[model samples]
Target: MPESRRRKAAVQKKRAQENVEIEKNRELKGSPRWWAPLMVGLMLLGLIIVVTAYVTGGNYPIGFDNGNYNLFLGFGVMLVGFLMTMGWK
Candidate 1:
Protein backbone atom coordinates (compact mmCIF):
# COMPACT_ATOMS: atom_id res chain seq x y z
CA MET A 1 0.00 0.00 0.00
CA PRO A 2 2.89 2.37 0.74
CA GLU A 3 6.44 2.72 -0.57
CA SER A 4 9.32 1.53 1.60
CA ARG A 5 12.30 3.82 2.44
CA ARG A 6 14.81 1.33 1.04
CA ARG A 7 12.90 0.99 -2.22
CA LYS A 8 12.62 4.74 -2.64
CA ALA A 9 16.35 5.19 -2.01
CA ALA A 10 17.22 2.53 -4.53
CA VAL A 11 15.00 4.08 -7.16
CA GLN A 12 16.47 7.51 -6.49
CA LYS A 13 19.99 6.15 -6.78
CA LYS A 14 19.18 4.50 -10.06
CA ARG A 15 17.64 7.65 -11.40
CA ALA A 16 20.65 9.68 -10.32
CA GLN A 17 22.99 7.36 -12.18
CA GLU A 18 20.83 7.51 -15.26
CA ASN A 19 20.69 11.29 -15.08
CA VAL A 20 24.46 11.50 -14.78
CA GLU A 21 24.88 9.35 -17.84
CA ILE A 22 22.44 11.49 -19.79
CA GLU A 23 24.21 14.67 -18.81
CA LYS A 24 27.60 13.25 -19.73
CA ASN A 25 26.32 12.18 -23.10
CA ARG A 26 24.77 15.58 -23.72
CA GLU A 27 28.00 17.34 -22.90
CA LEU A 28 29.88 15.57 -25.65
CA LYS A 29 28.09 17.50 -28.48
CA GLY A 30 29.43 14.92 -30.95
CA SER A 31 32.24 15.19 -33.55
CA PRO A 32 33.32 18.25 -35.53
CA ARG A 33 32.18 19.19 -39.07
CA TRP A 34 35.48 18.14 -40.61
CA TRP A 35 35.82 14.90 -38.65
CA ALA A 36 34.06 12.62 -41.11
CA PRO A 37 35.80 14.10 -44.15
CA LEU A 38 39.22 13.81 -42.55
CA MET A 39 38.56 10.27 -41.44
CA VAL A 40 37.39 9.22 -44.90
CA GLY A 41 40.30 11.03 -46.54
CA LEU A 42 42.80 9.19 -44.38
CA MET A 43 41.23 5.86 -45.24
CA LEU A 44 41.18 6.60 -48.97
CA LEU A 45 44.73 7.91 -48.84
CA GLY A 46 45.84 4.66 -47.26
CA LEU A 47 44.13 2.67 -49.97
CA ILE A 48 45.64 4.87 -52.65
CA ILE A 49 49.08 4.36 -51.12
CA VAL A 50 48.80 0.58 -51.43
CA VAL A 51 47.43 0.80 -54.95
CA THR A 52 50.10 3.25 -56.01
CA ALA A 53 52.79 1.05 -54.57
CA TYR A 54 51.51 -1.81 -56.67
CA VAL A 55 51.09 0.26 -59.85
CA THR A 56 54.52 1.88 -59.51
CA GLY A 57 56.16 -1.38 -58.56
CA GLY A 58 57.30 0.19 -55.27
CA ASN A 59 59.95 2.25 -57.04
CA TYR A 60 58.45 5.61 -57.95
CA PRO A 61 56.24 7.11 -55.25
CA ILE A 62 57.44 5.16 -52.25
CA GLY A 63 60.93 4.11 -53.23
CA PHE A 64 61.91 1.22 -50.99
CA ASP A 65 63.66 -1.11 -53.43
CA ASN A 66 61.98 -3.73 -51.13
CA GLY A 67 58.40 -4.25 -52.17
CA ASN A 68 57.30 -5.85 -48.90
CA TYR A 69 58.19 -2.77 -46.87
CA ASN A 70 56.10 -0.63 -49.15
CA LEU A 71 53.13 -2.88 -48.56
CA PHE A 72 53.64 -2.63 -44.81
CA LEU A 73 53.88 1.11 -44.97
CA GLY A 74 50.72 1.35 -46.97
CA PHE A 75 48.87 -0.95 -44.61
CA GLY A 76 50.13 1.03 -41.65
CA VAL A 77 48.63 4.19 -43.11
CA MET A 78 45.37 2.35 -43.70
CA LEU A 79 45.38 1.10 -40.13
CA VAL A 80 45.69 4.64 -38.80
CA GLY A 81 42.63 5.65 -40.80
CA PHE A 82 40.69 2.61 -39.59
CA LEU A 83 41.64 3.35 -36.01
CA MET A 84 40.32 6.88 -36.38
CA THR A 85 36.91 5.40 -37.07
CA MET A 86 36.64 4.30 -33.46
CA GLY A 87 36.18 7.94 -32.35
CA TRP A 88 33.79 8.78 -35.18
CA LYS A 89 30.25 9.70 -34.29
Candidate 2:
Protein backbone atom coordinates (compact mmCIF):
# COMPACT_ATOMS: atom_id res chain seq x y z
CA MET A 1 0.00 0.00 0.00
CA PRO A 2 1.18 3.51 -0.72
CA GLU A 3 2.01 5.78 2.20
CA SER A 4 -0.34 8.71 2.57
CA ARG A 5 1.16 11.99 1.38
CA ARG A 6 0.80 13.58 4.85
CA ARG A 7 2.50 10.63 6.50
CA LYS A 8 5.37 10.73 4.03
CA ALA A 9 5.79 14.45 4.59
CA ALA A 10 5.94 13.96 8.34
CA VAL A 11 8.63 11.33 8.00
CA GLN A 12 10.64 13.61 5.73
CA LYS A 13 10.33 16.41 8.20
CA LYS A 14 11.57 14.23 11.02
CA ARG A 15 14.51 13.11 8.93
CA ALA A 16 15.38 16.67 8.11
CA GLN A 17 15.38 17.55 11.78
CA GLU A 18 17.64 14.63 12.52
CA ASN A 19 20.02 15.67 9.80
CA VAL A 20 20.20 19.18 11.22
CA GLU A 21 20.97 17.83 14.65
CA ILE A 22 23.71 15.63 13.24
CA GLU A 23 25.33 18.59 11.53
CA LYS A 24 25.20 20.63 14.72
CA ASN A 25 26.87 17.83 16.60
CA ARG A 26 29.51 17.55 13.93
CA GLU A 27 30.39 21.19 14.32
CA LEU A 28 31.37 20.48 17.91
CA LYS A 29 33.35 17.34 17.08
CA GLY A 30 36.90 18.64 17.01
CA SER A 31 39.22 20.40 19.42
CA PRO A 32 41.59 23.19 18.48
CA ARG A 33 45.06 22.13 17.30
CA TRP A 34 46.75 23.19 20.51
CA TRP A 35 44.10 21.73 22.78
CA ALA A 36 45.17 18.11 22.63
CA PRO A 37 48.86 18.90 22.94
CA LEU A 38 48.26 21.16 25.90
CA MET A 39 46.06 18.57 27.55
CA VAL A 40 48.60 15.78 27.16
CA GLY A 41 51.43 18.04 28.26
CA LEU A 42 49.63 18.96 31.43
CA MET A 43 49.01 15.31 32.26
CA LEU A 44 52.65 14.43 31.65
CA LEU A 45 53.82 17.38 33.68
CA GLY A 46 51.72 16.19 36.58
CA LEU A 47 53.19 12.71 36.34
CA ILE A 48 56.71 14.14 36.34
CA ILE A 49 56.05 16.33 39.33
CA VAL A 50 54.64 13.44 41.32
CA VAL A 51 57.57 11.21 40.43
CA THR A 52 60.09 13.90 41.23
CA ALA A 53 58.58 14.39 44.65
CA TYR A 54 58.85 10.69 45.38
CA VAL A 55 62.43 10.46 44.21
CA THR A 56 63.51 13.57 46.04
CA GLY A 57 61.81 12.55 49.27
CA GLY A 58 60.47 16.11 49.42
CA ASN A 59 64.00 17.39 49.96
CA TYR A 60 64.70 18.96 46.58
CA PRO A 61 65.43 22.21 48.44
CA ILE A 62 63.07 24.29 46.28
CA GLY A 63 59.43 25.26 46.46
CA PHE A 64 56.91 22.37 46.46
CA ASP A 65 59.47 20.29 48.30
CA ASN A 66 56.92 19.24 50.88
CA GLY A 67 55.93 15.61 50.44
CA ASN A 68 52.14 15.74 50.64
CA TYR A 69 51.86 19.16 49.04
CA ASN A 70 53.79 18.06 45.97
CA LEU A 71 51.47 15.13 45.63
CA PHE A 72 48.48 17.44 45.84
CA LEU A 73 49.95 19.82 43.28
CA GLY A 74 50.62 17.00 40.86
CA PHE A 75 47.19 15.54 41.26
CA GLY A 76 45.55 18.89 40.82
CA VAL A 77 47.32 19.41 37.50
CA MET A 78 46.33 15.93 36.37
CA LEU A 79 42.76 16.56 37.35
CA VAL A 80 42.59 19.61 35.13
CA GLY A 81 43.87 17.64 32.18
CA PHE A 82 41.40 14.83 32.79
CA LEU A 83 38.57 17.28 33.05
CA MET A 84 39.57 18.81 29.72
CA THR A 85 38.91 15.49 28.03
CA MET A 86 35.23 15.81 28.78
CA GLY A 87 35.00 18.81 26.44
CA TRP A 88 37.24 17.39 23.74
CA LYS A 89 34.50 16.09 21.56
TM-score of each: 0.71, 0.67
How many steric clashes between backbone atoms does each model show? 0, 0
Model 2: colliding residue pairs: none
Question: Candidate 1's residue-wise lDDT over 1-89, tens digit each?
Answer: 99999999999999999999999988788878998888888888888888888888887456887877777877888898888889877
lDDT of 2 by residue, 1-89 (tens): 88899998999999999999999999977888888888999999888888887888864423663478888888889999998988785
Best-fitting candidate, measured by lDDT?
1
What's the lDDT for residue 45 in model 1? 83
The best candidate in terms of TM-score: 1
Name the regions of candidate 2 deviating beyond 4 angstroms.
1-25, 61-65
Q: What is the C-alpha lDDT of each candidate?
A: 0.84, 0.84
lDDT of 2 at 22: 97
Q: Tell me the spans in candidate 1 whose CA falls farther than 4 Å from its real position.
A: 1-21, 24-28
